[model samples]
Target: MKNKKAVVYVRLKEGVLDPQGVTIQRAILNMGYDVVEGVRSGRFFELELADGNGDLSGKVEEICRKLLANPVIEDFSVEYT
Candidate 1:
């Protein structure tokens, strides 16, 4: 079995309030970076797969849905490399 890597990004869903993001954006503006429009706080997870071929995508998705993010408030995307 070949080893592989997967990256999972979890972020707040649309219409959800992100106070952290708002605070960061405000700080950026206060720092004179007016060009900064907004910021959204999120989570990134890197996982090593022991076996790359055994339903890798499915496993990653399951992990993201079950552990890495809150399904009701956040959405996640998976990337393999």
Candidate 2:
């Protein structure tokens, strides 16, 4: 069996205020770089899983919703590789 990895990506939802993103965008503009219009920040987690049945995806999704991400203010996406 091949090894697998689950990558969970977390980001603030649309219409939500992101102070870190705003700060980074301002700093970029202040540096005289007009090429950048906006910036958004996010986080990701990598989980190593044993080769098992097809239930790994579902488990990772549940983990993200329950612990890794805040469902009210943030959204999460998962990828298996």
For each candidate, give its TM-score against the true structure. Answer: 0.88, 0.89
lDDT winner among the candidates? 2
Distance from true location, Cα of 65 in model 1, Å:
1.1
For candidate 2, what is the lDDT? 0.89
Per-residue error (Å), model 2, residue 68: 0.5
lDDT of 1 by residue, 1-81 (tens): 343888899999998999999999999998989898979999899998886376578777888898999999999998777
lDDT of 2 by residue, 1-81 (tens): 343998899999999999999999999999999998889999999999887665677778889999999999999998878
Candidate 2 weakest ten by summed lDDT: 51-60
Q: Residue pairs in steric clash, candidate 2?
A: none
Q: TM-score of the candidate numbered 2? A: 0.89
Positional deviation of 76 in candidate 1, in angstroms? Answer: 0.3
Residue 11 miss distance in model 2 (angstroms): 0.6
- List where candidate 1 sits over 4 angstroms from the true fold: 1-3
